[model samples]
Target: MERLAKGRHHLANRTSLLRMISAWESGARDASDPYRLLLCEAYGKSPDELGLGGGTEHVRSDIGLAYLGSLESATSALGELARFDEMKHSAVILGKYMPDALNAACLDWLFGESLADLRLSGSKVTSQDVAEVRTMTENLDRLDRFLGGEQCRLMALRYLRERVVPALKASKTQAVGRDLFSATAILCELVGWMAYDTSRHSRSGTSPRP
Candidate 1:
């Protein structure tokens, strides 16, 4: 109580503290964001590691609306996300369509498009391009294992915007196109995972509306 009073928390009074504790213990109320933050500070662990409500509860949103119809759309969405992250407006893109968008894109890659002849006048995509994308993705996966998915979020977006997406705009064989699109689908899932992590951490106050 004294620490809370000195720290300017709303639950600084002993009476309020007792009531809050009683509520939490009796399951009448779950801890709010502010209380969860204070508890995290007290425990010196992450919310998920501590099993806080932020980790246990699901965040609802319309992220499913972000459907990816082609490699072009995937690239554009990823570019937008990269720009948003740079502008510190990442929260804006984390909407309800995320899961659906990822699912659609993945399905497209897995069983949808056959990409028989991506005919272009300029230089055609070769095995080297596919290999490069695979290498970069593998590297990104390694980074995720070491640094956690959140750490790779911005870099993943940047890579998709600059490298993979641009490659999509270039002419490629049908086979090469298929490979590129499949890789792009995987990349979209990566971005979605990052978005999920971002949403988990930023979730404060009320749960997201469906």
Candidate 2:
């Protein structure tokens, strides 16, 4: 907390700051406004990176709207889209719908160069990982059918951001990688449909096509 108050003259008392920190950490209170900014600075991370949702610096309003050139870029774009949707709660008013951009994205997808092979050193991605994502997509589809996409879209986005996107960077055989990409594409399609069901048509158009 001292680190957060370094140059500030009107600092809260140490005891009060400790109490605030305790409350924030315990989920008894949100770290709002100036405190949130202070936490971000002290940690050298954006609020979103710290799991504090309201920071505009890290929230790209146009995320996932264009066709990226490589697997790495596509993976990063997917993470950004999922994070934005999760944080904004499918608020369409904050986004613009560009049919032209969507058209270009689709054209690029159909005729663009194939993504280069990824052979990074990380956890090994196997056929089982692909199956798990497919299974989760199926279960989420069932939930969407019953509960509506608005009710369940956040869950799907969270899984895509937290689980599947990271797995895309992991080490995998060529066959496993192909299968994994196919499974992830199906999941992305489901997420897009869920966004559409919630009336986030722009979001549906922007989901990663890989």
Candidate 3:
């Protein structure tokens, strides 16, 4: 625990470390975004894998949510956002940082989980597939830059839900896996930025990009 506090958790004091541990174990304090991240990284586990879900506050939406833990969890959160976009929900949704979720994801990336070889037994994901995704993302980036972030949100969400997520679920080689993960990361960043923009626009009573 001491080592975790000083080295992994970066806690400043022994008393605070013991108190935090006790709180986390006893469920007295929900793990905030930062601490959750430290715990996840130190342990090489997901928020759910470490039985830490109930101990943290969940961001109801990703618009304002700044942190995420693992690719899997971040993907799941993106799925939720896609559903909302599909339903034509309001873009003014607000969110807070979800430490545990973001922490796990950060640790996963730091440990090269995102770069791991993918094992698959189905049709190969070709270089062409990767190129297509890259092109599409570039186009979306251009669109967002010219029109506005809001202009690209729906298109980004659709691409993610219809194309990216499906490809990720399928099997592919290490090369393809790296490309796909990279593409997904780009898409996620685009969507998150767009969402944040939309929220800002809504708050200021300004119109979104047409």
- Which tens-of-lDDT digit does each residue in 142-161 have in candidate 1? 78767875558767767776
- TM-score of every prediction relative to native: 0.49, 0.70, 0.50
* Position 207, candidate 1: lDDT: 17
CA shift of 11, model 3, Å: 54
Highest TM-score: which candidate? 2
- Each prediction's Cα lDDT score? 0.55, 0.77, 0.58
The candidate with the higher lDDT, 1 or 3, is 3
Better of 1 and 2 by TM-score: 2
Candidate 2, residue 78: the lDDT equals 82
Candidate 2: lDDT of 89? 34
Report the Cα lDDT for candidate 1: 0.55
Assess the local accuracy of residue 52 in candidate 2 as a C-alpha lDDT between 0 and 100: 67
Q: Where is the poorest 10-residue window by lDDT in model 2?
A: 84-93
| lDDT of each residue in 1-210, candidate 3, tens digit only | 345556544554768868877887885534544566667888999765776665123435443243343445555555545544443434433333344545554464566434223334456677787788888888888898889855577787678777776676567777887787787777667666666676743322211110
Worst 10 residues of 3 by lDDT: 201-210
Q: What clash count does candidate 2 reach?
A: 0
lDDT for predicted candidate 3 compared with the true structure: 0.58
